[model samples]
Target chain A: MLNVGKIEEGFVLDHIKAGKSLSIYHHLQLDKLDCTVAIIKNARSSKMERKDIIKVECDVNMLNLDILGFIDHTITVNVIKDGKIVEKKQLSLPKEIKNVIRCKNPRCITSIEQGLPHIFVLTDPQKEVYRCKYCEEKCRQRW
Target chain B: MRHLMSPLDFTTRELEQLFDLANDMEQHRERYAHICEGKKLATCFYEPSTRTRLSFEAAMLNLGGQVLGFSDASSSSAAKGESVSDTIRVISCYADICAMRHPKEGAPMVAAGRSSIPVINAGDGGHQHPTQTLTDLLTIRSLKGRLSDLTIGLCGDLKFGRTVHSLIHALVRYENIRFLFISPEELRMPSYMTEMLREKGIAYEEVIRLEDCIDSLDLLYMTRVQRERFFNEEDYVRLKDFYLLDKEKLSLAKDDMLILHPLPRVNEISVEVDDDPRAVYFRQAQYGVYIRMALICTLLGLTGEEGGNIC
Candidate 1:
């Protein structure tokens, strides 16, 4: 059995779909931060058959929960302080996300414009649909 | 500060006010002759749309404003790889207001975000052409005497007809507007549009032939159905004539029914039908100029008493 140490501060992202820990790690830009991160892939779970987990050692306020929520709201965010669970954070869909995903529509202005920010606006929260701000093309969630 | 990115950018009440201004401008052109005398309009058409560009230029010129800018991207700074944002910021310094038409969807929107002057989306790929919608609205209101409680038939290439979709959306905001969609099976209005109508409980019907529903229409909006939109030549050949509007088809329509086409038309509307009193497509083009004049005045905050306080 592989064991990981508890973080003194920061987030313990739990119940991420298996194999998605690496994606979450890169999306959260944890690698760019000057802190330790432990990634546990395919961890056995009672709720999910197998899931990925990420433990970050940094300030709790450093992480952008909106990106986390937009990526996978089903994942649990456990905030830790002094190596103790402080708060269980909940994730909700963001109204707008910028530069996270590129508009795939070839006819979209963002495709040809240099240095244009790829913006997606949440049009349908019930169906979790995000449309490109420029072309109104629905984002096909790949991840 | 306000830019027209979509037809819905203006509410129904605002549209009514705008139509009133357009009607007034149409009635008394001399009053609005020199309202924009000192203002300059920059027409930055990245794609060549001679009809739209000319109409905008005519509107500004009619209002006594100067017109300038390149008609195509090749002649403009865009050929030098200038971004829409950068170009609009520079045009802001030159013109009091700007009209932009680009081949790519949402290019005007990108420009609007960075522009110091108001940006009118002349047309953006197949995404939107708000001024066209405004023109349609103004024409229906002026000729029909009202915009509501009427049966409108939209014919040809509904699947890809951005104007049809925009018109449908704009009209639904009015009360008791029924739609008759006429097109071949392959080019029927998309399910999303029909679904929207259904959700709103607005009445609509889908038909394959224009002749079948001509007499029942109060207004008929026609668009060309290109052969390339069909899957095979056989289907295109079989279905092409059914959608064509000829004198025979016009005979079946009501005497007062208005026929409107966003022009530069092909065989979808027979040239023989042009002389028919019911065919108002030419008059619709005239209305385009009037509506654009109203739009420029409104956007520049020049629509006050006697053409408002012009800066």
Candidate 2:
């Protein structure tokens, strides 16, 4: 049994799709924060069969949560307060995002200018598809 | 007030309205002579172009508007590494409307984001040419007298032809649009595009030979397989002559079938076919100017809701 301390006043990212915790870990820049982070990989789950979980010892902002949602909306964010689950959030795709991921299309103007911030709008929420605002190229999420 | 960056920018209803406006401009040319008087249009070509630039300038000038701006990237501040955003912002201060062509795809899109005025995408690499799509649509509507229930054959470089891609995206909105994609195995339409067609439930067929399908087509849209698109010189040399349309091929096509091209044609279309009554590429080029005139007037808010009463 691996023993990890519970988050007393922070977020618990639960039910991340298996094999995506490392990317979520780096994408959220969890290492830069002066806080204890426990990333439990391949945790057995009834819903997902296999999942990843991250319990942070510090309260993270909504931007970080949105980033997590963008990565994998199947994630369940549990806000812990006073050593208890105070609020549980079912992540949904964001309506708009800025500078999170670069447009990978080489011909896209964003690729050449290098100075402009990449912006994507959620065109089809059913498919979890985000389209680049300028080029209109569909942005595929890389997990 | 919206910029024309992609074919998807305008809805089907909007396109029909635009086509009607173009019709009015064609019938009553002198009535719309000075509709855009004192208005300025900027032709910002970040790539070398002959027809698209001239068509836009001619459109603006025919509407009694002045034209300005560079024809090539080397002449513009883009040579000094000026961003598309900055260039558009600066041009917006001078021109009432701007038409830009860039070798980089979506460059006009970036310009549209920063410009205060309407931005028209003349051509954006191999990504999109919305105005050209509009011209094609208008041509089809006028010539065929309708926009639905017809088979359109897209021949030659389906891979890199932005016009073909945009036209497909547009026509799929109509009823019974059967697409016949004719190209060599290597130059076939992109799988992603075919996937989109499948997802939309649009019927399409792909063939290596034009002879197999050309006779059944209501329209044959021929495209130049550019040597510039190929990384390997050998592949370019091999594929360049793979889909050439000559008098022999046209004999198999329908008598009333429209043969169109987004011109400045290479050897893909033989000059001998120009005299053929079925060849409507020149007429298609003429319609390009009128459609653009309608676009400029509408974007500048010179026309009414019905797109009438320019004079």
Candidate 3:
């Protein structure tokens, strides 16, 4: 039942983890933008219990998908036009996501100075573990 | 396709394809720079592994591609208890491919299952390190000229050394390969691998002394014996140096034999051994990249001649 004011055309990101709105904000470089955007943190969600929301007033390509990573699968993206959703899509991880996440293994040759651009090809989507291109270490999300 | 969830997933032919591609990439370096151009590689590391993380970044850059991702889980959404699946589902939109590292076993497999792109398993707990196996294959192919019919000795903490297990698993596919396992009795190769060796019907020998057959080995793989693996500190001190290979030990080794180690050495190998011609651990590190380059290329759907993948 949560709603935001209509925009000419844009996207609405829903079901994000609570209080992680800032990371997504930075990832999209929203601060540098001149367009109007709204970040709703600590919102009540029937699906997530507690979640964050993002409303982008400007047209953007797949930026909501990037934010979904910092949040969970509870994310829903609504494509709006004339103040109504024309499309709604749920995101999924690509088998080979580029430069969107970092490998966690420090001993990985990729982590070394002068190392190549670290490439992680995800092997398991359910577990979220990736392999290092150089060291061959299976990397995971490290907080 | 891109995700490497398990070592078992790589068919022999797939591994060969990776090797062949790596060889080609090494030979014709500049031509393939744009193979993955405009593509992005996202590395989502949930732990503190500097080496593995950077290697993925470097591989992407070498291919004339761009890179992005978070090094720390805290810096990313994972710090807030976000599920790995949800995170990747979202990252999939931004990146063409991804690599992830986690502490939990079988985590990468989960990520790969949900992803639309290919997944590459970097490492998963003490379970498997397939890419390291690729590095080993490249190293063996380079130094030994082939992988078959060699006396391969695995020394040090065999029980917990993921590399040793993966390498052993990989080498079993070759003909007439003999395994010489040298380790403290407490740290002998684990039962699972031992059973696997038995099931595969590969010949092997167990020993505590490094000198017994140093001259007979075609390859010597040394691993660290972490103090955490031992109960008494004195036992560690006694057994730790029991296997150290100095110049004296190398003197008995065959001139053609190569000494390899999964490194970050803690005095088990004498610094003087660095000058020895047989030392190839540093080369081992370099092979890590070339193998990765091949893996990235193949996983990203760039085809090479005679190419096929494991299930």
Per-residue alpha-carbon lDDT of model 2 for B1-311, expressed as tens digits? 78888877888998888899899889888878888999999999999988899999999999999999999999999999999999999999999999999988778878887899999998888778888999999999999999999999999999877789889999999999999999988888999799899999999999988889999999999998887788899999988888789999899999999999998788988899999999999999999999999999888988734445455
Regarding DockQ, does 1 or 2 come out ahead? 1
- Sorting all predicted structures by DockQ, with the top scorer first, yields 1, 2, 3
lDDT of 2 at B100: 96
| Stretches of model 3 off by over 4 angstroms after superposition | A1-143, B227-242, B304-311
Give residue A39's lDDT in candidate 1 (0 to 100). 95
- The TM-score, computed over Cα atoms with residue i paired to residue i, of candidate 1 is 0.94
Give me candidate 3's TM-score against the actual structure.
0.65
Chain A TM-score by candidate, in order: 0.96, 0.92, 0.78
lDDT (CA) for every model shown?
A: 0.91, 0.88, 0.75
Give per-residue CA lDDT, model 2, range A24-67, as digits (tens): 88888888888888999999999999998988888757337677
Q: What DockQ does predicted model 2 obtain?
A: 0.67
TM-score versus the correct structure, for each prediction:
0.94, 0.94, 0.65
Ranking by lDDT: 1, 2, 3
Q: Where does candidate 2 stray beyond 4 Å?
A: A42-50, A60-63, A123-127, A136-141, B304-309
Ranking by TM-score: 2, 1, 3
Q: List-wise, what DockQ does each model earn?
A: 0.84, 0.67, 0.02
Docking class of predicted structure 1: high
